[model samples]
Target chain A: MTERVYAGRPRPGNNFELYSWFFMRISGLLLILLVIGHMVIMHIINNVDVIDYDFVAARWASIGWRAYDWLLLFLALLHGANGVRVVIDDYVRRKGWKVFTVAVLYTFTFILLILGSLVIITFEPIGMGS
Target chain B: MYRGGEGQLSFILHRITGVGILVFLFGHVADTFLVGFGPDLYNHAMAIYRLPVIRVLEVLLAAAVLYHALNGLRIIIIDFWPAASRYQRAMFYAVGVVFLALFIPAAITMIRPLFH
Candidate 1:
């Protein structure tokens, strides 16, 4: 905690933390909605087996499903990745460890996000019947 | 014996769980990508997930998933915001309490579904 003088100038430091602080709140609120909605749709919907290649093929055929899945994918990856980023920011004390861990996390996060989205958008069902 | 284990323990556990979740995510990606190759591979891959031991593992994975998600949200607030540091202790307890509250119900729902 910093002390404020009689003057109006408040404080000076990196605003990166400030933005990340706000990101957590906003993303947390959104994650609650997104994750719950995703769970209900995918998990609790009668039969889990109904969600196959054909099911996904039908769903993503619609722009609505595409948009919904895209948002869910984007939000979840950002939310989880940023979450990991914060953990690294806090615990990885050594400079080398900090850089190494964050870099590794960021690399994997990007790979997962890209792969997940690509699969969701481009699924095909014709091969399933074969 | 676990006295005053919340602060540093929370920090250490969060890192461990985050890495664990990423590992799970990679496995999930690999399994999901198998669907693209063909249905036989996809079905076979999924059947592997249907064993009793795998079911138990899935339950643990779900627990780990929720724990990492909720706790990460809590730490993000305290670390990134100076304002949150004031109520950090309170918020830490709040996070644990709320995580248990939600997680217990979810666990019960999951477990009960199996028995029924």
Candidate 2:
């Protein structure tokens, strides 16, 4: 008789990895919608040619668009960061190199997340009319 | 090199596209953040995006995003429904069909401006 391996549900003990795995799928489902919509509006419908400072200013002038962008920024950064972290864990074997790369990854992800959020939150519609 | 089947191919493509998009995202956020520097600097950066080469790259990026998104859905299905693995090969083809369907039109739209 062939042996049956225990490849069913994840066993208890590591809640963090379990949550991270769940986050990837959930965030991914949302991203397919969020990012595809973003592309259609920014790249297809509008095209880069039409997008300029004034265009952005006008868009951000509305709180709705700001909120939409802020959500996208937040989710995409976390999703991408976690995805890369998984990749690093899989391939980078050497202890020192792995630690260094992961450190850099976290550092950049943190900076970009903060920087993007600040831009969205603190944007002023300068010369865009109140 | 395991040299497996469709599953292997999908897994490899997922990694490649995910990394590519992440790298692009960092640059994109930095560029968009330039808006705070005022219009002159922002528009100057926007001009680079308008260049023909970057436009072509933009289409490639769209393809990457599309593939990653579709394949991601496939992964989810297989994860939630173990029965789905039996048909994963067919679903992989389905992902391809949907990718082409959506990507071709979007690619055309993005590239159309280059001729103008």
Candidate 3:
């Protein structure tokens, strides 16, 4: 068995690690529902070939679909980013490399989140018809 | 470093699934962005995803997500509810049961389209 390692000195109040750990669980549970629903709808029930511009546009035309997808995007990204951070903390022993890797991860995650949010939130299905 | 213990196995699988989902996110975002280009482009991209290889990959992805989500709940209970920590092994088994219960049906749904 891989022995659990506690790497850093314990921090004081407003425990970020505790919050993040909790967030992972909450977001993960939500994601299972959202992502699985999405996969079922897109790949199983509807089929990917049927999910064209109009299909997407029609789906997004409803606020419900937009909200569902937005929530899915937000939770999945945050959960995945935090999970990767924990993985980095666990394996990357060197301080400098750890910082560098984490920095890159944060930057990449931030950009993706921003771009994804923009696409989902600002989507205009009517524009696609033109 | 993993010795094939139940705990270690779950731990490793969680990381693998986490990474797998992240990778899929990249492609998903890119594909979704194709909507901005027009229906033809978006439909074309969606069409490519219908290929046999991608369908097979979807089954594996479903399994990974199921295990990760179920085991993740177990980890949460262990962390927050002190008493649950004592029965961690049992919880792990429970996670497996729930995972299979969900995943088997989902896998069937995902693969059934391929044969039709």
Candidate 4:
């Protein structure tokens, strides 16, 4: 048995939650295609042993690969980070703990996104010492 | 806190797989970032992934991704089409069937290199 209690608070007009929900569905659909393609190419089409420096170099040498990887990195990270935030909100009751947890998650996500982008965009095959 | 049901199980699995994929993403990004350090470091890191245990983990990852993606589609459909909500349980089972169908072949392919 649940009792309804009235909390005196003004309702917000923003549809942030609605948009976030939509983003999850759309990004998830895209991720399925991107991640499957990535796995198939990296693991199935070619085995792990073959993915040495030269293979990565050649793959990243192309602009297409760079774009594909960059999109995959950004969407996957954002989607996962947002999902984690939802989990944190669900489980964390304390205001301070919730803020701190979300802060750490966002910070790490930011750094990883930048790092991943830089690596994919600036990767040079020739730089690898023979 | 929902009790036992297909809906509850689907919800729980979606959360678990989402977190699982996130963990894998962290390791993956770290390993790929090694490329900036040079080929030796990058290749060395990749070599470590070929171990039997790691290969098994890869299979698990594949399973997670498959379930998440399939269940995600179901979620999207239910969200946009209210009428489909009645078939949510059936859709969950369909996701499981599709996941296993795809995952078993993927797992076999993943481990084939190890034996050869």
Summarize candidate 2's per-residue lDDT along B1-116 as a digit string, tens digits.
Answer: 21378767888898999999999999999999999988889999999998899999999999999999999998888778767766778888999999999998888888888887
Across residues B1-116, which tens digit of lDDT does each residue of candidate 3 receive? 33456767777778898888887886787778767766677778888778999888978887887787777777766655656655766777888888888778878877787888
Cα lDDT of model 1 by residue, A6-36, tens digit: 1101232569766665665677667656766
Q: Clash pairs of candidate 1? A: none
- How far does residue B29 in candidate 3 sit from its true spot (Å)? 1.6
User: What is the C-alpha local distance difference test score of each model?
Assistant: 0.65, 0.86, 0.77, 0.83
TM-score of chain A of each: 0.78, 0.88, 0.84, 0.84
Best-matching candidate per TM-score: 2
Displacement of the residue B89 alpha carbon in candidate 2, Å? 0.9
DockQ of each: 0.22, 0.52, 0.41, 0.44
Worst 10 residues of 2 chain A by lDDT: A3-12
The best-first sequence of candidates by DockQ reads: 2, 4, 3, 1
- For all predicted structures, in order, the TM-scores are 0.69, 0.93, 0.85, 0.91
TM-score of chain A of 3: 0.84
Candidate 3's residue-wise lDDT over A6-26, tens digit each? 111122146888777667767
Give every collision pair in model 3.
none
Docking class of 3: acceptable
